[model samples]
Target chain A: MSDVKKFMYVNRKAPYGTIYALESLEVVLISAAFDQDVSLAFVDDGVYQIMKGTKTDGIGMKNFSPVYNALGDYDITKLYVEQESLDERGLTLDDLMDIKYEDEDDDWAEKPSIKVVSRKEMADVMDQQDVLMSF
Target chain B: MKLSVLVNEGPYQHQASDSALLFTKAALEKGHEIFRVFFYHDGVNNGTRFTVPPQDDRNLQESWTALQAEHELDLVVCIAAAQRRGILDENEAERQGKDGNNIAPGFRISGLGQLVEAGIESDRLVVFGD
Candidate 1:
């Protein structure tokens, strides 16, 4: 419980093509177990990680996109997708998977977990974090 | 101030490990305490004693080993990443059914928790990677 810092994981690479996305997710999952204030920011090609309809059957790889859905269950739900990256890829928030979590503070109200933010807003979040782990 | 260094790339293939080493050296010269250098992803390759670079070139692994010897640095290679990339320590090699270990001097294979600990304990966690 000591030395709990605001940890931010930056993901700027796409999934499946390389191992960065999966490895980043693994670390994020591990960080979640620590009860740290963890946030995951997806920019550049990384925004594709949360995109809906991620079909990996053609490539014969595990569809790790589902892991994003489980982030809420693990209490690691602050998922940020940069607006610039998503717009550059011709994607809107509707193209992303429906991720949500139940808030006990609000009598178990379910709220959307992913946040679509501007690059500036993402930068501000980065500045606020005590640690930044990029992948 | 205490500093933690994170290297996410391997040896000569990328500048990450090299940059991390140089940064660590400079930080030490400035009288800063290095809490730990946690190697993750492909960076675990730097811990292998099997790396034999050309005599003419700077041996990256040797540089790190020398740093560890000179300053008693905490160089930790993530066990999960190491196992995934075949950089096994003596005990890990035996447990994983390998013939022998190739972990370099001064570098120890540990779990990813060390990284989290370093991130928390150190004033700054500088990551050098691709």
Candidate 2:
């Protein structure tokens, strides 16, 4: 196998309604397990995945926001939110879990070195990756 | 670098397609080559030729068609998903004995091999799915 060192995972779906969120999370965990440098970004409705205190029991689904916290155990700690997405949804940093907030900055301001970026910056970040997988 | 982009959401249904388009445009602008763009699940709707969004609104299908024409982008719709959703090309419509094909030009009917090929050949395979 080639020594692929970096990976970026972009999540673009809501949490409960479909399999995209869950499967994307699984893929991130698996990529991190292989010791690849993994980072995740949430765009559009995907921002819901990291919202604080999500309760899914009323909808007959298991609460899964806790998985966000568990991501730290796998060393896949670079979690990003598109600034435009947050602004469009009227969400602030306090409304989210413990994740680095970045807006077009390639360098992040949190643990695990995951940078949050804007839609415009995605191409540059993507270009720097050895492996990029979106879910 | 080789690249594969997975588009899972339908055009105009959400921002996923827009973001995917922007990403593809940016990737190309930066001199990166896209190996393939795979449409899975509801994304196959992107290949529909019958789409006619209200004249007042933006026509995403036209935008995608323009992109394909401009770059000769490899647009592939998953056969399984397209079949389930009734989006068929001429070959597929004939093979399945359907009356007609509704898929748009510049879009081809293909399988997971295109996706696998992207994963294997590209330096990175990014997905834009919902």
The ten-residue window of minimal lDDT in model 2 chain A covers: A100-109
True-vs-predicted CA distance for residue A118, candidate 2, Å:
30
Per-residue accuracy of model 2 over A49-129 as CA lDDT, tens digit each = 888877777899777777777776676667767878878999876778764333234464345323457878766676776
Candidate with top TM-score is 1
Each model: TM-score of chain B?
Answer: 0.98, 0.94
| Candidate 1 lDDT score at position A126 | 92
Deviation in Å, model 1, residue B59 alpha carbon: 0.7
Docking class of 2: incorrect
State the lDDT of candidate 2 residue by residue for B47-69, as single tens digits: 99999889898777777788889
Error of 1 at A123 (Å): 1.5
lDDT of 2 at A56: 78
